[model samples]
Target: MYKPQLNMESLERCVKSLEENENNVRDEAQKALLNICRNVLRSPNDDKTREVRLDDEVVVEKLLPAIGAMECLFDVGYVEDGERLFLPGNVSLSRLQSLSKLLSAVSESKPVTKDIEENSTAQKAFFKKISKDFHNVMHYEDPDLQKKARSVIPIAQLEIAAMTKMRHLQKSYKFSDARKTTSSTQFETELTAKDLLLVELLHWFKHEFFEWVNSPKCSRCSTECVYESVVPSTNHRCSRIELHRCEKCNIIVEFPRYSHPEPLLTLRRGRCGEWANVFTLLCRSLGYDARFIYDETDHVWTEIWSASSKKWIHLDPCENVIDKPLMYEKGWKKKLTYVIAYSKDEVQDVTWRYTQDQEAIMKRRKICTEESLIQFLRSLTDQRQNSSNYSSARKNYVIMRSLLELADMLYIPNLQNKNSNEIYEGRTSGSLAWRLARGEIVQADIEKNYIWDVSKYGKMFELRYNIVKDIYHVVHNDGTILEQKSGWQEGTNITNGGIFRKVENDWKMVYLTRSPQAQYGCIKWIFEIANSELYLETFKLRTKSEVFHGARVSWKIEAIFSDDKVIVIPVSNCNNFYTEDVRKAVKLNIIVTLSGGQGQTAWQHAQVFRQSLENIEEASMIINIQLKNH
Candidate 1:
């Protein structure tokens, strides 16, 4: 009746004894181990008092929250771990698109297959796991890909082929049988780690609640076809080509490698064109007969002539043709059959491994280069920002993950759990939150776990992770710029843009509106999320130095949502900043703040200000720039 405690000793033993005989015992044991790992860092050892009300009656509150300096906790999955977990086959397609973003940050020169060619059991297991995970995501209906020879396709082939492989490839290698279980070498451990994680992920997919095999089937009669193919009869529309099963035969595209056939064996959501692009990418990377059909479908799929298997095969990820043909007009018994349609783009002047102009190759290389990574990170930074700059901090969440991928590939270790933000925060070696904000840790330390290089485990990858993490913040131009004064205290005399010094005595407040004239999307934020959160206990500013002065200040911002900022001078106008063009035309002199941060980089404002149409036409209350001539 008693549950076991989750601790390192128990969990390590649990992971070691993964192939247990009993399922229930294994589940409980694994749960205990994973829970201990996941909750290790979150234990009650902190000092900050924070309250989180889960609901009116329920609250998960933390007080005396002590931020760990060197305390380490791992987030291995347990029961609660399902919250953020990628539940196997149910993972979102948009989430998988994240792989594009993930790989985009790494250098092209870096090897994409750190775990691919390992000559050990663990290595083979890891590769298999990766291949299997990839296999689940792939829904190509084509069944002929298995017979193709492997390796990079020549440029000539790509030019002649219909499809070209580009990125994201998974391949496998095996160690000599005698050396597969040799635990003495580091390779064995690396292989084990890779394989175990991969298999775990596949098992997760296989047991998914909505796995293809679990998809609802047609209730008409007892059953029909259980195939994963995109079979459509000439007389039937796609809406009618729903899931079905046949009691006579378990009709599904069955792979020799798999014991059971399921929809994932060859069914993707996209049409022929989308499926072709994937095949092209896969085959180009692995040398195959992938071609782009230049017809209305523009379908890009791969092909192979299996001399042994006899039939010419198609790796149509869009339609699994394992048991039968995917009909085109064949559904209506029309002349244009599936075979005829596929034959349309069968072969043209170009091959699958086609090369492009030097510009494209250079461009792809540049975009995914180490230098490019640095530039992107720097582009995200605001050089003039002090500690108070929280405007673009949210983007750092994505940045953190992308940088982590790069770090892991380079064999970085300390980077795996780096609180490296100290460099960006302009602080000493100690940064509490930075350590916890490792959103990029998962992919950044990808292959570092089991590299062959001895120094790599200790230094190389560790160094890379640190370097990448530091660069990300640097690119973002992050730092804790210590002010000349001890603490920040605002006052009434907030210069044109800066608030006054004494305003901080109590929380002096003012109403800000989107400038009447904003050229770009600058005015969008003010109307969008300006009043999202409220600041209470506010002070007010007078229209003029004294109450009811003739001069007034006009604002363009509108507080839309949450609590409103108290407005003392609701309707007023003052000398708004003037433009040089207007100044030259008027021949009048007035002092005003001309430029904020302008024209330095890509995304900034102050150079071009525009007024919205509503503000211009609906002149119910007017606040125009004033003139002062001496």
Candidate 2:
């Protein structure tokens, strides 16, 4: 007999490694020990002869509840990663399975058209009320709210009915060989049956998310390109983009921006691939056992065996609806627009597609349409739109949990430094700017207020000799470095951050910093060589609103060398904070000075500046005195 270690120390090790285990070691240990044979409850498994050993009971008593506890915690979080949810060890699988069965029985007990547990008199009133409610709902101007409300209850009701039918059928089936059931035919068939129930659950979840999204009533951009998927309603400033679509309808959409996903599904490099990965993660996280299969034609889908609905469902997110062919067929209904082929490499793992299975798949497809997936909403509902949010739904709760864990384990220690000016891109703003001691320039002009001046584009100004060329460096979120080097394109421009075709320059640039928060935004540096001299400066503001803010402002005055890059050094005026060309220096402000140089062949320079200093660098530049907040 193996001695069981019941101490927290040993259990803690088990808990940690359970997540780290790739061989399903933790899961096997857990399942083998959890919920010692219970006669009071019925299991989806048909076999009832297995005996629970003493150690098995001990494992359940000691570790089962700990696992089940995760279900109650909607916000399961990673230890430094409060941005995501964490599944605890206390979720009771038995309890969940039981609830699923019960919910299913409710739907199957009496068809919606019929009500009342015992008497016809009660049925009459229930039907009458439902009829009246439906009529009133249609009269409302905003049908969405009522429509969602309508979707929620009916879905729940349908799930209950379907589950009840499934409970009866499941009693006759044996799943003892689940892990070892390698027969693709049998495994595929069973997998479909399980997915039916999972899809039913997703329907209600979809409706619930919309309730949260719409409750705040804010203006949303439904343009083909923009996505507004914020949650909790009132946090408007925090709203972010959910997904990005290219200009082609045929183009595939990418969500969450992860590397390509294959071996699970053969989706191409775009939207189809994204949807497959998102749906697969969500389904498994929700406790719905599913398998991803790809067809030779590259189609992917899942089958859910819903013991509650007494059927297996086919779910195809790409179709934007549930594929309910068999169930509708059983009812003698013709093929509706919602049905489609669900194949994995030109094969479907099912011997039969029952009515319950058909209905469950169709329902889930409707709920999990791309428009309603957590991947879409969470990707949008964050300050960065980087998939940082807590989804209350069952699927998202676990997926979020796993992501939180993965993020924590994979996070690089110096990650923030890598994102020095990354937030400007996170904002997905049309414009980007860089500010530094050199000067300011615009690679792409985004200010509608000054779009008319094509002159500001190609103007190149010479500030020093060593600042040879106008080029800068940028770092992406993935830690890749990008060098931004631009010059006068084919089109004729006066040249640089100055004016084109204009005889004189009209702006000056200065470097300024106010607070730590302000330091996080985008800043670009640009260098220009015009009239045999090199001009160095920065263009580092994502928007025009940040052009002027109080802080320290400085001009570059280092000695210029004939054949070297311009050495940049800060120069302060007697007033302690003033620019040579500036008349009035405002506190908490940023300035780019305009300088005109005489030359029939005039030139200008600019760049985007992004710098993240370490603690040592910060300490060296720290000012003792605290300044008033701007």
Give the winner by lDDT: 2
Give the alpha carbon lDDT tens digit for every residue of 299-354 in model 1. 23344423233233344343332111222211211111011112211112111112
Query: How high is each candidate's TM-score?
Result: 0.19, 0.20
What is the alpha-carbon RMSD of candidate 1 to the true structure? 28.5
TM value for model 1: 0.19
Clashes of each: 88, 102
Q: Per-residue CA lDDT of candidate 2, range 342-371, in tens?
A: 211111213123222344334222212333
Off by over 4 Å in 2: 1-522, 530-560, 563-566, 571-630
Residue 395 lDDT in candidate 1: 45
* Worst window of 10 by summed lDDT in candidate 2: 429-438
